[model samples]
Target: MAPSLREGVSQARSFEFLRLGRQAPWLVLGLGLLLGPGAFPHRARAAPASGADPAALLEQGREAYEMLECPKAVASFRKVLAHPKATPAQRVEAYVGQAWCQVVEGNEALARETLQKALEIRPDYPVSPDLSPKLAAVLEAAQRDFRARAKVEIDLDVTARGAPPELGMRVRDPAGQVNEVLVRYRTDGEWREVAAHSEGASLWTARLEGAAAGTLPLYVETKNRYGFVSGREGTAESPVAVRVEPAAVSAALAPPAATGAASGTALTPLAWTAAGLAVATVGAGTFFGLKAKEEEARFNGDPSQFGSHDEALAVGRSAQRNATTATVLFVSAGVLAATSGLLFVVDGSHGPAGDAVEPGFAAAAMPLHGGGLFALAGRF
Candidate 1:
């Protein structure tokens, strides 16, 4: 068979490459250099269809968000996240973008979940309020939710202590059961958790037995208590250095503030009454909601549980009605509790005698998301 024109061109290119590689090694080296990693830096990268770098993908997401294309922006950010070598900062930015997408989709709970992942990477990470005032407003609500469920703060009474260290820790833990242990590095560079005795009060005491005069990492684990069971690990930013002479310990009569309530203010009598009603109403709503959901789940659970198809349908409709009532009650209670902040706005706490109101208190209802915090510096 006769060779085609394509084959002839391929053979010609191959012959030229071979002639250069053998007869002129320097030219071959030059050619290899020109065709190496740097020459096709962006070619055949992951997330091929995007045709943009991670930074560009992030920008595309931002522009899409501004244009109100929530799904497109989310997809772009997801592509950025899918990059195998994504940095923590890049991951955080992608998460924030994804969170904004959730907010746009009217899923505050999911949005809050997304932001929590970002905060896990950089604990004190803040969100920029000005980027999108509405979304930033959602972030404020999300942070409150985070603080309620999983905030972790550990305060030590002394960092430099004696041979046997008694580390007094005042933990503002929203996640359940704040567990701590002193971890020391062995001569072979392996960390072993040292046995420690602990006492609980407003301040929980963690006393390390026979711990030498050296630096040790104070490792803490936080667990989810109420809804789900999960955990995360955190380290003391500053390591503990046990010293020859223990540092002077200070004592105070006042008790430490509780987790998620450090900035609380005592309520007035009228405010107290309104707050009680709000709490009561929401509590009732939750009870009914859970009971109704249980019924719905059973109806959907197994076929044999039902006596008849019509009976199953009737049960389903009943559960639906119950759920509808729960929704109405939850909304009503949320409205009442949400507007309760207005009462605090005039709680006899004046700010600079005529400036803007700082409202010495902060509260958020699920829908309002009005009163938390936002920071541009929180951006990676």
Candidate 2:
């Protein structure tokens, strides 16, 4: 394979590795949960404190919990649990309150188990109790709701014509489940499903339709086999926004209508002019150089004839002058041709109407005209 192809593949692999490294923390967290919490370090229980006011701490914890202050409530509850004078009922309530605070802060599983421990401690704990009923409701809601996340990875293959003349997408869920993704493209104030989900590895391919292309917001939603729709997670990976830009759109869309058209027309003529100048320069130089060599050969062959010698000397001098003139013209033409060619390339790559046109065609054209005048003088 070519060096460029090798470099591209290496870059792609490096990017993939970096992305996976970033997601390593989430993977480890999931694996730890799957392996069971007992496999991890157990949270240390707060030791019993001597002569602490249990009622006051419970009230403080309740206030913190109501205010949605999870850390503060957890700290106050721990203090209440640690009090030696606290009854079994009060201790259970403290655990239950801590669990409720955890649920409010979005730690669902820990909250459920903490509530379970409270129930186990006091089986007669009233399910209809004000705080207990509210905690139960929160847990039930969490369980009933289907939480899901998704991410899209885009790989742009740059070609000679343009970068990613076509577009595609791949979507993956947290459970390592791949789904055939469809994208509804937004174009000219309207939305259409440009690409249908084909049988592939969660990869959907679509061709770019026009020269004016941008990032189209594609709404992607998927249903599982059980018909449960994935709820939107506000995280970066979920409902990934893919940005697609067609190559050289700005160049193609250059305006000031008349100027743009003139510049575009001028570009082709400039290219051909440069090419013609270069070929002419090279041919002129070569022809004059060969004639000078022939004149030198005749002078060397008959040096004995004084009259012929003077004539040959004049012929040699004239040939030398012609060669010198050709060399100067060749060099001048070459520089102008190269400059024009460079301008044409730059104008073609970017838009032709701005700073690009001013320096290249405008500024250099004057010097080029002067050079042509000098070449005409040399010809005379």
Candidate 3:
């Protein structure tokens, strides 16, 4: 016969009572008291879910959440919420945890949406209340930390002939922790960064807004996490002066400079003139040297062997005249070549010239002058 439900329950309770009574001392010892078959509680058993290690799994999910592992954290939290025994509070916490992970992963819009769902689960959730203050603190810290990187760019205008000017920077700070960096004007003082950041060997960039042209004073202040503020002052910064003159001013300046050049031109006719003089001097000197050699050859022979005394004297006089003329022409050529070279160097410094004087002219003239001098000495 089938057992009645009441009788079955009564038998079960009686067996439990008998087991407990015998194991009173063992119960006190807290061992082996519930080992007997009749001591088992009657409850429906459920199959273990796949891959479930609830405690360790939940802890892993929380760690991923803190590390901003959005997808993994969301998956884990979803798993926890699917558990049959998950309370309303636990479900709400899971939603909020997923939302925080999203925020850290830069999905602000999704984070807000997830947070709305969390709020729906508990109409007055602490997540929203707690998040506001923390988010505000982060933004404030970013702003304050970014302030130390303020920098100004300078631009200058000056006359073309004016002295090359340097840029100067002045920073004023009431506190002394921040320091100023000295920078030279690069490419007309273009926009540049004033600070750098490091993230575990990775470099991060800070944003720099546009800088206005002209002289400006900038201040930089830095603070530690504990709110100790210090500032530094830098030297004043000025733009390189760029000179822009009216057409009239440029025209007026042109004529006087041209007149000066005209007068200078009279001093140096043409490179060919100097070259011709040098060639003529060399030729004259060569002629004298040859004549001298001939005279010496004649003198070395018997005294009465070749020419009349008058003929020899006339040859000697001609050689001396050629030598003297060669000396004068060679000296003049050297002076002219030197003057031309100096003018060319000066013109090169100013700007592009219509005609560039070659250094070869001076080089050629030097050798010619030396040849002429040597020929003159030979004549003596």
Which candidate has the highest lDDT of all?
Answer: 1
Model 3 alpha-carbon miss at residue 306, Å: 99
List the candidates' TM-scores in order.
0.33, 0.24, 0.21
Per-residue CA lDDT of candidate 3, range 122-200, in tens?
A: 4323322223444433323333433333222221112221112222222333222223232222233453434422222
Least well predicted 10-residue stretch by lDDT in candidate 3: 361-370
Better of 2 and 3 by lDDT: 2
- Prediction 3 global C-alpha lDDT: 0.44
Per-residue lDDT of model 2, residues 73-159, tens digit only? 789889988888887667877987777767656687887667655543443244443234445565444333312122223332221
Assess candidate 3 and give its TM-score to the true structure.
0.21
Ranking by lDDT: 1, 2, 3
Error of 2 at 229 (Å): 54
Ranking by TM-score: 1, 2, 3
**Candidate 3 residue-wise lDDT at 58:** 54
Model 1 global lDDT (CA atoms, 0 to 1) = 0.58
lDDT winner between candidates 1 and 3: 1
